[model samples]
Target: MLPDQSYHIYNHANGSENIFREEENYRFFLHQYEKYLSAVVDTYAFCLMPNHFHLLVGVKEEAELARTFPKFETLEKLVSKQFSNFFSSYTQSFNKVYTRKGSLFIKNFKRKPILTECQWQDTFLYIHLNPIKHGFVKDLRNWKWSSFHGYESAKNPSKLERSYYLNYFDSWQHANYLMNIKKEAIMKEEME
Candidate 1:
């Protein structure tokens, strides 16, 4: 998670467990994520499914982080620590509420850098369409736990870095057009 780099971060629940059992659970998880990650990264997109979650984020520039945490020796270390704390805090609260114990998430979550325009577009559609791919919904917009709604609505300017990514498409209309094309292609593949 280097500064100014876009990474696709993902993690799954341990075994066959559901990370979120109710709507409130999703809200709580997002709250914790914002509490820990907002200052360190600019959230581009996200999707929270029953057993897993995905986040497209750009790590804040070194200068931005330095201004926020003047004493931090390295931005990478600080960002990593924040992520660790985010998971631990969420897991602890979840355990206490559910009357269960042990790790809720798979050890050492995975992340891949978004190094190209194609990867960026693919990752965005991949995350938004996860519910459909998993048979949880028939349409991407039907899922309430993803940032798809934010992108489509063009609201919540503060939460998602929508403008930054939409710029890649030149306009919201173009972005939606591409999303539909991708969705159709995926659905066509599935039907084959």
Candidate 2:
């Protein structure tokens, strides 16, 4: 959650239940995420699945955050609070709509800080490949819930920092390499 750092953040549902019950659920969750976290983090890539989600984000620089929040000394607290609010808002609405109760997600989410180029790339491809590994789709092209669609956009004109991450490779074809990966081996290279 620290500023100026990249993290592979992920969390699963409370148990066997699914976090995203419908297509609108995924869209609503992303809208909430962008509303609360955009100011504090630069989103790179993300994958929203049925029961869980993965996000690759880099915390904004201190100066950037300072402009968003006057009280800069408590930058960490503000950033953390934004995430807490985002989660709570989504859960509240979900419960109201589904007529359910209790926490929707597990108690604590997992965030692995990215300190190296290799880890960042690994995390990016790992996230983009999640749907395929989980049996949602045989091809990444067929999955509509992931940020991969953003990358495939005509100008990459989405909230996702697609161009920045793609810059790591030689060209867009390099990103196509994700499709070349075997399904069984992808989940094995866990982010941690």
Candidate 3:
């Protein structure tokens, strides 16, 4: 969660429940995410599964955060608080709509630092392919809730930092090819 650092942020629904029950739920969650997180973090990629979601984000520089939230004591605290608010806001609305109570997500979300080039590439692809990996979809592109479509369509300029990641590959096709190769390698290892 440090400034200018890349992290893989993820969380799952509590118990056997699904975080998103319908298509509107997914859209609402994303809308909330953008409203709360867009200023503190630059989203690189994301995927919203039935029970979980993953986000690859780079924490914005302290200076940028200062500009966004001028009264904050620390940039880290500001960013973390915003994320907490994001979750709470979504959960509260979801609970009211479903007439359910208690926590919707685990105590705290998990975040892993992306320290190496390999980990960064792998995490990006991993987020995009999660629906397919979980058997929710056979093709990555068929999954409507993932940033893969954003990257492929190059339409969502406001959300994903697509150009930054695309620079690592020769083309979008090349990126997909490498992602499939990585997926195959992972599946092979899982089988062994």
Task: Give the 10-residue window scoring lowest on summed lDDT in candidate 3.
Answer: 182-191
Ranking by TM-score: 1, 3, 2
Error of 1 at 152 (Å): 1.5
Best by TM-score: 1
CA RMSD of all predictions: 1.3, 3.4, 1.8
- The pairs that clash in candidate 3 are none
| Candidate 3 structure quality by residue, lDDT tens digits, 67-182 | 88999888888888989999999999999999999999998999999998888888988898787678786678789998888877886565787777864567788889998887
Off by over 4 Å in 3: 155-158, 185-192
What global local distance difference test value does model 2 have? 0.86
- What are the per-residue Cα lDDT tens digits for candidate 1 across 1-192? 799999999999999999999999999999999999999999988999999999999999989999999998888899999999999999999999999999999989899999999899889878887887787887777899999889778755659887778646778777778777877877788899
lDDT of each: 0.89, 0.86, 0.88
For model 2, the stretches where C-alpha displacement exceeds 4 angstroms are: 154-156, 182-192
Q: Estimate each model's TM-score.
A: 0.95, 0.91, 0.93
Question: How far in Å is the alpha carbon of 105 misplaced in model 2?
Answer: 0.5
Residue 48 of model 1 has an lDDT of 98
